[model samples]
Target: MTEKQVIYLDFKASKILLDGDFNAKLSDCGLAKLGPTNGNSHVTTSIIGTYGYVAPEYVATGDLYVKSDVYSFGVCCLNY
Candidate 1:
């Protein structure tokens, strides 16, 4: 993953792809955004993503950060 990538926003089992080598790649970046590269937060008025994958903090407030992706990734891991 690139440092500039803040979060997958919609991360889930369906969005992950594994190659023949078993290397995982994230896909469906339509909801991805270029956020704080320094690990800060980015606030937006609009929040968009899949349910259950979205962070609770982001759901309460429109603030998005790298941790939001972590939250979604955690959910995906639990599902797997």
Candidate 2:
């Protein structure tokens, strides 16, 4: 499997069901990335999703990496 797939599976397995006090608290707040990605990258597609949940850079460009998983994890954390 790819690195991204491994991360996706890891996150899915780690997720908590979203019907509790912790999710309620996160519902109102958002998280930020610690830094930007390397500028020298390439992407070749357009996809659809909520802006907050989509990694801004990855959506604009196809340049994905392990950090992209970090962005998805943050959004999933909010939902849970």
Candidate 3:
């Protein structure tokens, strides 16, 4: 996925689903936001997501970015 795509604001281990064929799928997109590709971020007033999986910058400033979801994906990978 590129930065121009949507960002899964609630990305976490619990939000992922693996099928019998090991196909990964993301769920619970109620907090997702559209990411910016011009080196900018999507800012919001509400900060909601699972602890330990949310990005530090997002937690500090409610700024959403594609990297935030990438951070959560990395954490999920570490669990396996």
TM-score of each: 0.83, 0.38, 0.74
Clashes of 1: 0
lDDT of 1 by residue, 30-79 (tens): 88876765555574648799888899999999888767888987897898
Task: Provide C-alpha RMSD values for all models, in order.
Answer: 2.9, 10.0, 3.1
The 0-to-1 C-alpha lDDT of every candidate, in the order given, reads 0.80, 0.45, 0.78
Best by TM-score: 1
Give lDDT tens digits, candidate 3, residues 1-80: 55357878777777789999999888778877777756565645478888888888889998776678888888888998
- How many clashes in each structure? 0, 1, 0
| Model 2 quality (TM-score) | 0.38
RMSD of 2: 10.0
The stretch of ten residues in a row with the least summed lDDT in candidate 1 is: 36-45
Instruction: Please write out the lDDT profile of model 2 over residues 26-71, one tens digit for every residue.
Output: 2311222222234433333344444565567767664444456577
Model 3 Cα displacement at 46 (Å)?
Answer: 1.9
Q: What's the true lDDT of residue 29 in model 1?
A: 88
Clashing pairs in 3: none
